[model samples]
Target: NQRVLVTLNGHPLRRGLLPRADGSRYLLFGQLVCRRLGLRVGDTLRVTLAPDPNPDQVDLPEELAEGLEAWPEAAAGFARLTPGRQRGIAYRVDSAKRAETRLQRAMQELEQLARMG
Candidate 1:
């Protein structure tokens, strides 16, 4: 398995081709990636891709880990989610500047997910 490094409009970044339901692969230019590269819809982008070594990499926040550890059901639910969903939760948990706020957000997110199931 290989990851990918792409240069979009001269702005370099690493990403991977995502799987489509129809069995095709596509690169998603996410909001953060687009904004960083000053890209917009309908704008032409020059993209160059190269093979990458590390693919399954995500930084799960410590506070979120603590929250998950304390909530077994939420932990299992989190484990059941796809890698993308897990990263989305990790992103939200890390968004807060304050540690207390991060913990609160992390716990809140787990509780919300628990309720959803």
Candidate 2:
């Protein structure tokens, strides 16, 4: 799998290129991206692609960071997770708009990591 930084009509996105059976690769736009860009099926786009400088980097929420700090085993477990999984978890937590919700999601992830350990 190749990670890429994509620019669609000037909007920046970080995404992974999915491999096809024919060995070609494609990018799948999520609903959020579609809505943000007002994209529709069969619509043409001006696309630019570049290699992701830090494909494995995930922005850890402060709440998640603190929780991980307090739980060494959970931190270790989190480190063991695949980059995709780690990004998924961090996205869940980071997407929460409210502070309380972010903390809640972070704690929930920490609990799951604790169980994994």
Candidate 3:
């Protein structure tokens, strides 16, 4: 396993390299940061520690905001989730390229959390 310092969402995140169940290099970041970054198993990622990669603020784009608004029920349900879960959803959505895909993922996560709840 290789050791490296990495930055995630503007914060310094130190993690260890470990083999995944499928025998790939996996990063073992803290649970909180992992949720905050919205990374999932087998997700490809890049990290640079020294130069912080500051993500923009959490204001959803106009179109995405409209989409989220269209699902008031989902948004309210999401609001009831723990801050960690909320951050997880936000992080995942922010990582998407297309607004539609982001909305879909956010909705999917909301459904999963709802089922768990």
Candidate 4:
């Protein structure tokens, strides 16, 4: 996987390479990225790419791990989610600095996932 710092019309942001559904590889300049930079489709862009030294696929928070351990149905549901969704959940849980907050968020999201399945 590669991590790149992309400059879109002089605005900079970092993003990683993603694997496409058809087994192709691509980089995404998402709507938020474009919006933040006041960019539109067909706008010129400057890109620079390099290998990420400490690239992490997804950093699963301990609280989320424990939540999965405690809820088998939630765990099964979570397992069936797309990698992007799984990674998003992990990132949200990990973003919380406090242990209790992380745990609460983990349980909330996981329970919702379970109910949806």
> TM-score: which candidate is best?
2
Question: Which is the better candidate, 2 or 4, if ranked by TM-score?
Answer: 2
Score every model by TM-score.
0.53, 0.67, 0.37, 0.52
Give the alpha carbon lDDT tens digit for every residue of 5-67 in model 2. 999989987889999999999998876568768999899999999999999876687999899
Candidate 3 lDDT by residue in tens digits, 1-117:
344466755556544456778888766565545666797777777767432233322434344456457766666766676644554567676666776887787667656645544
The residue-level lDDT of candidate 2 at 97 comes to: 66
Q: What is the lDDT of candidate 3?
A: 0.59
Candidate 4 matches the true fold with a TM-score of 0.52
- Badly placed stretches (over 4 Å) of model 3 are 1-64, 98-100, 110-117
Candidate 3 backbone collisions, by pair? none
For lDDT, the strongest prediction is: 2
Reference-based lDDT, residue 114, model 3: 52
Compute the lDDT of residue 24 as modeled in candidate 3.
Answer: 81
Q: Which tens-of-lDDT digit does each residue in 38-97 have in candidate 1? A: 778899878899876555555578988877788887887887787777778987887776
Worst 10 residues of 3 by lDDT: 50-59
Order of the predicted models by lDDT, top scorer first: 2, 1, 4, 3
Q: Report the poorest 10 consecutive residues by lDDT, candidate 2.
A: 28-37
Clashes of each: 0, 0, 0, 0
Report the Cα lDDT for candidate 2. Answer: 0.88
Local distance difference test values of all predictions, in order: 0.76, 0.88, 0.59, 0.72
Off by over 4 Å in 4: 1-15, 18-57
